[model samples]
Target: MKDKIILKVETAGTRVDAYLASCLKEYSRGYFQRLIDMGHVLVNSQKTASSCRLKEGDEIEIIIVNKENKIKPENIPLEIVYEDKDIIVVNKRPGLVVHPACGHPEGTLVNALAGHFKGKFVPYLVHRLDKDTSGVMVVAKNEKVKASLVKQFQNRTISKEYIAAVGGNVSENEGRIEAPLGRSHQDRRKIVVGPLAKKMAITEFKVLSRHSGYTVVAAHPITGRTHQIRSHFAFIGHPVLGDETYGGPLKIGEKSFERQFLHAHKLSFTHPSKAKKVEFSAKLPKDMAWLSKKH
Candidate 1:
């Protein structure tokens, strides 16, 4: 299917690609630039360069060509928390990959969503939870909703809370970890607390309960980063239990865990279409809940 978008420029001097990206928040400037290069974008009925400056009242047209989706829909079950015309909230289960990747080409959440919404609408991911992390997640039903949600994430207006079972006793009732995180030089796959192309990562946490060898803490990541909570806790010598990559023990006492003890417990953000604040919570899975009952 091909969709055409036409816009009349209100502000002048902005580049065509930039203007289009701003107007159609769902697409990126680079994407618009590619369209311009392919002669799919036009200004006043004439093909134009991506860098061409726009004038007030200039009529711009964008032709979006949809390609055949290669990802097949699978009838995988999902724990849907809430759904509406614009978005779907789900309590993502552990060990489920959110999106398809190199080794994980199918059986993903996206594929399942496709199956669920088959013939209705395509699901657009605004944010992601790790493959092993179980928690509240939201998916947009359309590009307009996706753009609004993406903007909220970019502005850090979306609030998130996580429950983590980490090794060792946390001395303080609450504390903040303000550290920079970047990809490890030695391991491209690993993220670490360092200055190598670093971006500031901050995590504020409160000790919820203390157990024999571990502590369950409520973590609020002030700034999102790759593995921010795991990396920050590991930096403080308190790697999350079951996180082998971060030095966490696979077994704590008699119980064993197959994945890291991190759960996205709560998420809050402004509703894209409602223009109202909304929040969602996911109950702790059996494994994580098991730790809370222990003395």
Candidate 2:
């Protein structure tokens, strides 16, 4: 089905992509850019590039070409942290995929949310966490709220904190890793730093405790990138414990570990409905907690 929307710009000078992202909170900037690229979005009845700046009172028409629904809702359980009419914050457990993809076609958090919501409202992912990385995640119930949260993330106004146990002891009590990241030519699934890196990535960490040969630390990623924290730590020679993809140790101090020791402990963002700052957090899972005790 196609949904056509026409609006007259009241403010000038905003990029078309930015304007669309702001107005359509449910879709992402990337989605909007894709639309523009496909000539689904037009300014004054003429197709325009996503980077084109808008002029006041310019008429914009957007043709939303929605994809056919393919994902099926499942009866999977969810650990909801916070919920409102606009958004839902969930404490995602390890081993659960955030969304359905190639290998995982069902039983994802999206499936759980779809079942939980029961089609009363649409569930849109604001961000994501790795399958093995347990943490707090927020989902938007409506497009407006989703757009607002997306802008916050793009502006770096949202704050997030993670906890990870790295192999070997870290020398610095607190440090920052500012490096560019890019996909490895050698391994398509892995990421690399330095000249091999093609995108800017930054991560900061403060050591929490040091174990026999491991260190637990709080990590803050200034930029959201695929495997940023894991790759950054690995680049620094302290790969996350149990992260097999990044050369992390599978066993730490006689304990058999199964997954990456990375957890999203805290997330803070401005509420779209309430227009106020809100923060959410989740405790470490059993394995990470046990690891801390051993350390």
Say which candidate scores most in lDDT.
Answer: 2
**Over 4 Å off in model 2, which ranges?**
1-69, 292-295
Candidate 1: deviation at residue 24, Å?
27
Model 2 per-residue lDDT tens digits across residues 28-144? 999989999999998977999998999764767677788534346689988889998999999999999876533455778888988898867667777888889998999998778
Residue range 102-167, candidate 1, lDDT tens digits: 355578888898889884877777777878989999999888998899888889999999999999
lDDT of each: 0.84, 0.85
In TM-score terms, candidate 1 sits at: 0.78
Output the lDDT of residue 18, model 1. 88
RMSD of 1: 9.5
